[model samples]
Target chain A: MDFFIQQIIQGIAMGSLYGLIAIGYVLIYNAWGVLNFAQGDMVMIGAFAILVTHIFWGLPIIPAFVVAIIICAIVGYFVELTSFRPLINSSNTRRLIATIGVGIFLRNLVRVIFGADPYPFPSIFGNTPVKIGELTIIPQNIWNTVIGFVLVFLLTVFLNNTRLGKSMRATAQDREAARLMGINVKQSMSLTFIIASVLGGFAGMLISPVYFVIPTLGTSLGNKGFSSALLGGITSNPGSMIGGITLGILEATSTNFSTSIQASVAYIVLFIVLIFLPNGLLGKKESRKV
Target chain B: MTLFNKVYKATRIWILLAVALTLPYWVPNNYYLQIFCLGMIFAILTLSLNILSGMTGLFSVGFIAFFGIGAYTSAILTTKLGFPVPLAMFLAGVLSSILSLTLSLPTMRLKGMYFAVATLAFGEIMYQLFLNWTAVTEGTKGIKGIPALELFGTSFRSYSKFYYVILVILILIIMLARNLISSRTGRAMLSIRENDIAAEAVGVNVPQYKMISFLISTFFAGIAGALYAHMVRYVSPESFVNAESAAVLAMMVVGGIGSIPGAIVGGIGLTVLPEFMRFLGNIRMVLYGASIVLIVIFAPRGLGGLIERIDNILSGKQSLGVQKKQQHIEGEE
Candidate 1:
């Protein structure tokens, strides 16, 4: 029982990191109606950006985090303008292939620049274990949970209340209608990409300390984020979060209990989720609009 | 579907087969010969995967099931039963395809992406079993000392000999694939990809089309797997993982999904490109990732589309580009 509790906590931490990355995927799909295969890698780029800024550039965590995310966001904005916007206007297959190409390029570039070796990044939260009865949780885990929830909460507040966020929502709901309403639809779409990228950037900073920072990090997490995006069913933001953490639990449990193959739990969970509930737990059923 | 069309197809295949059979002598290096052989192996797998994903649009993230099954079946048969190489491999391909087909039939009723998910799930389960079932597969260590293909009195040795055998297999497989895709069966698949319900409503027999796609894809997949087992003389579960499957799918897409020639180009281009990227050293993956993003964003049509565009320009014809009218006219189907 205690072990299960610990596993769940561990799962939540991992799930939150995934949820953070998944947010970028969900955000892209919500606005663009396309899966950004490169989102996880973008998160990877974000996390690496943080590591380079802090460890390599010798900047402190607070400022590095901000700068790294901003940099990542700019990179994402460029990716959107160059790749996605064109695809959004082009054929469906064109967009799919393009996103996949972007994902491949990004992952390979990381390998080229950083080497394939996993880099160690210091934890943003100090190395301390929090004790609660028989269960001991890593402070990083708690921080991840707190910050992830907080980030989404803040995002919700922003999307609901702020002018820019409202513009994004309107654009997401209906591009033509939003454009008719005098909202700059194209700019809003770009901003959505920027916001998602910024969120991914923050996620990378948050999780870098715990997970080994590597170029392949995005490849693994991208698959996980797909599950998260689907989990919230394609339309729900909070559901994406739930999907992330829940999948994390499934992964943690599978790792802890299932036989060898520490890495494939996500694939199994992904297949299971996809096979059983293609609609996802919270996702609205779109089904290619029949 | 015409007699003349059939004759033309056969002639073209024979020419390609003859080329594959005779081409290896031009290559000078033994190591390059080996790489050539491996390239053929990947091409076979890519062709197999193309039947499913490229033609039918049944996108699966896990195809390693048949690949691994072929390896395990061959390994178990040869190592335990002391079976002849030909018998073991033949049985491996057949059995692997059967296993893949049997598992796919019921689940295939679920259309589109759902089929992709189910196949992926099944693949994961098979990988887990291979890893966990230590008694047979030796767990993570995988099956080793797989006997080389011995036909008649001679053992397949030197990269050239192996290359010929693999090329023959790839040619035959490609022939089968070209035939299958160009036939009525192929039309049904493209229809399904375009719209599943519409195809069914138009009397396309959606279930049969899906099953046939899965069967043909896995048949080639099984052959490729057996080829890999024999070629590498070793098998590990990792070789058949989802990532490998994804890579194969990526090849199909990058090469030109649904285009047979595209699969070959994509697989070879990607595999060969990565080997060269080693010079970039540590920065290679970063470059690899960034470029994939850019490529997908820019070239949605993949390599096949690129070729078509170039062809149009070279032929002095103004291409319609993405306009639907020109696509239907240009597409062989």
Candidate 2:
């Protein structure tokens, strides 16, 4: 029972990290109707940014995290400006491929700058497992869950109450309609990218202590995060959260049975979900008027 | 005028055949010959992918899975079962087509990014299977010492010999693609790409046409894979990954999605460009990514469109406005 409970905690912690990244996917999809294939790389860049600030520059942990996220947001802005913006009127295939190009470029650029070696990320939470009634938990895991929930709550609030956030929602529903309503659709899209990038950075910083900072870290995680978004319905924020956590739990539990195929479990699940539940767990059926 | 056009077309084909046949003479050495061979192999693969993505408007990032299946099937057959190289190659293609048909049954319903992701998953699953199925795949140490192609008692062991073999295969495949694109089935595929609902309303069996397009593409991909395995005399999981699939997709896009001549140009250009850019070391990938983004932004029609534009200019035919109108209609659709 204790072992199962421990697995659940671990799964939740991991799920929260995935949820953070999935939020990025959801945010971008909602705002621009474009899936950013480079979202994972954005997360990777964020972790590297924190690593450089905290470790190399000897900055305080909290400030470094903040700075790192800001840098990621800037990167996201440029990504939209340079690649996504120019190809806004192009086909989805072209847009998707361009994002992939940006991903490839960013990943290779990091590889050139930092080399391929994995760097040990400095743990913001002190290195000690807290014990509670036969349940031993890492402090960082608790922090991860807390941070994830906090961000989700804040994002929900912002989207619901904030003017910029409302504009973003409007843009997502219909770009032409949003423009006619006197909303700055372009500005809202850029803001969405910035916010999504920041969330991706936060996820990276949160998970780096557990997974180590590596140039290739984003590839698999990005894939899994996308799967989570799909699992929850790409358009729903809360659904993404549930999807990420569920996938994380599934991954954790499956590892107990077979370690060899663990890497493929998420993808297999994604394939099944895509085929059987295209609308996802919480997604509405989208109708096309042809 | 009709007679002149016919004669000109015939003359061009003859000249192309002559050039292809005598390529080895002007080629400097084995290194360049091997590059040409690699380029031709990629050309075949890109063309196969084009049949689905370019013509049928299905986006698949997992054609490498079919390529890998072909490579492994041929490698195991020739090396383990002692089958002749030619028989193994044919069986490999057949198997790949069958597998693709099976995959299409479940995945053909998906559109756009959903389809891309599903295919991507399929490729990853195949890669993992190749890596973990140690007994058959030998588990990443890779299958080695596979024999090269032998025909009429002459072994194609040298680069020049392999070059001719690949060139002949490429020519045949190109002809096959050209013929298919002009056929009834080809028209159905183009219709599906233009609008699946409209095609279905017009009495086209959408699913069957999709399956056929996928089957044919995978068949050719399998042939290319088998050729690759035999030429390299090895098979490994590392060579057939998402990166490889992406590279092939890049080639297809760079060449011009549905154009056969574009596939050839894109395949050869991308394959050879990397070799030439080897001097830039790690930065080459950055350049590669940048170029892809730039190409998509500025010239989404790719090199094939450029070629058409040049042809129009040479003939003093100003049909640019008409072409733009056609593109606008397609885009609106």
- Best candidate (score: TM-score): 2
Tens digits of per-residue lDDT, candidate 2, B68-90, equal 99999999999999999989999
Give candidate 2 regions above 4 Å deviation.
B1-10, B316-333
In angstroms, the error of model 2 at A215 is 1.8
Task: For candidate 1, state the interface root-mean-square deviation in angstroms to 1 decimal.
Answer: 4.9
Write the residue-wise lDDT of candidate 1 on A1-25 in tens digits: 9998898899998898788888888
| Candidate topping lDDT | 2
**C-alpha lDDT (0 to 100) for residue B156 of candidate 2:** 92
Give the DockQ (2 decimals) of all models.
0.43, 0.64
- Report the error of model 2 at residue A113, Å: 1.2
Best by DockQ: 2
